[model samples]
Target: MLIGDVARHSGVSTRMLRHYDALGLVRPTGRTVGGYREYSAEDVRRIFHVESLRSLGLTLKQIGRALEDPDFTPSALVGDLIRWTEERLEREQELLERLRAVDASAPTGWQDVLRIVELMQGLDSTSAARRQQAVLTRPEGVPVPAELLAAAVLAESDPLVAGALRWALARSGGDGVAALTAGARSEDVDVRRRAVLAIAGTAEAPGAAAVLADALGDPDPTVRGHAALASGRRGVTAAVPVLVGMVVEGSHDVEAAEILGTLSQDPGCAERILAALTGELAAPTADSATRIRLTQALVELSGDTGREALRRLARDDDRAVALVASAFVAVLDERSPEVPGAEVP
Candidate 1:
């Protein structure tokens, strides 16, 4: 077959076939009587082989060696090609993700595009300070997309950077609530914990409360604790049980107690708080140390109910509990005179 015929039959471009001939990668076996290049059957087969190697990302030089070097084993070269292809694919995937983020931001100009790109790079920086600064220094007009902030907040490991990212997400007007809520369902407990924490900061956002309400049921105790605290601050009564549990378990128990006290100001919440604590205090399985912690938490409660509860606990059989509750009752008595109509029992 002639060069044109080989090009036509093999689907290889004539120019590329000429380049392959120049590189000694492929050459016609003979010439026609008219002085045209004539490809024998073996040359045509080599052309197909070269094209096949090219499809596997082999350079022309590598293909030449592959065909000519009898000592060259393809296993090592194929493995290297696989690695190179993987690296290229990774780069392409990263570029695609960046492009998708930019497209999602709906940038109005080059400046907006650049700002988003810069923020993304900053968020991905190895330095925690850089990540924090990325969130803290977000330009006023060129807002970081809520989705980007949500992802960063979920993945952020540094406490300071995570706080900054959560603040940024909150300022996004709960636009990233869907993304954050998705994170809350992650199999990764840390991701779910970060998700709930970020959502908690978005309390002012429209759907943040509902998302937190849903998060309160998360199986991860950390997730539930954050949701309970944030929801409690927002006056969600549904968080009462979790808050009470936090107090008993000594996980942010002080904050939990304070919030419980605040919630206790509502019509019937005080009785519930009192009942819950008293139940924990009265549990036969609760050790003396556990009872002491719960006793300390009672001081955080509001109204005569908490004071009176302490008064009852002051006489408990557990000496540590009695001593702590008695001491607290004494402090309450000393402070009672400061209030105009306060009665100390």
Candidate 2:
């Protein structure tokens, strides 16, 4: 057959066939009397083999070497190809993680309305009500149909979607803590963060503390921060040690300070939080915001010590920290002084 006939039969382009021929990778058997290239059925079969190797991610050079060796083991080539595929998959997964982080940083819009609507239908009526509130409040305006929302919330079983819906509900003043807790186990980091936030907001939910505790160790700093905040907001004293550890050890020091401030409202958590900020914990550089939060937490946990710390921090180089400390001290001064015999102030 001619080059065109061989190209069509083997599903290889004519240009590629010429290139392979030039490389001696899969040359035609012979030339016709007219000096035209001639390809036999055997050549077509070899072309198919080359296409298969290319599909398996082998370079043209590697495929040529394999094709040259008649005694080559197909099993060995397939094993190497499997390893290559796994590496590609791992790289793709990493890219996907980075993309997800980027996406979360941006604003949500109508482009995901259909997908969100579809996912929302898998929830119950109460859950759907919460999602509706969130959708209506969305900056993009409500473009999703009511039926689609109801159906998607009712039909889908995906934990990620469920977690998002439950989070929307909690944000809308609905009690979806049960749903959020259920979604905390999802492989999706965003879902877990949303679940942690929801559970933290709902004070009455059972097992919410445990879920938030587990989330403190999440690989993603964003998730860990949210988890820390949830633990603090819920006033889970058991999480004090963890929250203090985060303030001292976490990479996101700003978030850690915020969580520490929240946790410091509990008098029992005072010592741990103070230790985190005082250089005893040896956390990396303490920024103005972190120092401010630490001072605020100390005030909430221990009035005298916190006031003293605030007085000292008021002399800090960072104007923002000094300003906050000054403001807190002024507020404390404006309040009536406690008399020795006065009722509990």
lDDT, residue 211, model 1: 82
User: Residue-wise lDDT of candidate 2 within 3-97, one digit each (tens)?
Assistant: 99887777889999999999998889999999889998898889999898788899998898888878877787788889989999998985564
TM-score of each: 0.86, 0.43
Error of 1 at 282 (Å): 2.9
Candidate 2: residue 35 lDDT (0-100): 89
RMSD of each: 3.5, 12.7
Assess the local accuracy of residue 280 in candidate 1 as a C-alpha lDDT between 0 and 100: 91
lDDT of 1 by residue, 169-280 (tens): 7777538777788888889999999988887877767778888988888888788999999999988889998998887777998899889888888968888888999899
Model 1 worst lDDT run, 10 consecutive residues: 336-345
lDDT (CA) per prediction: 0.85, 0.61
Total clashing residue pairs per candidate? 0, 13
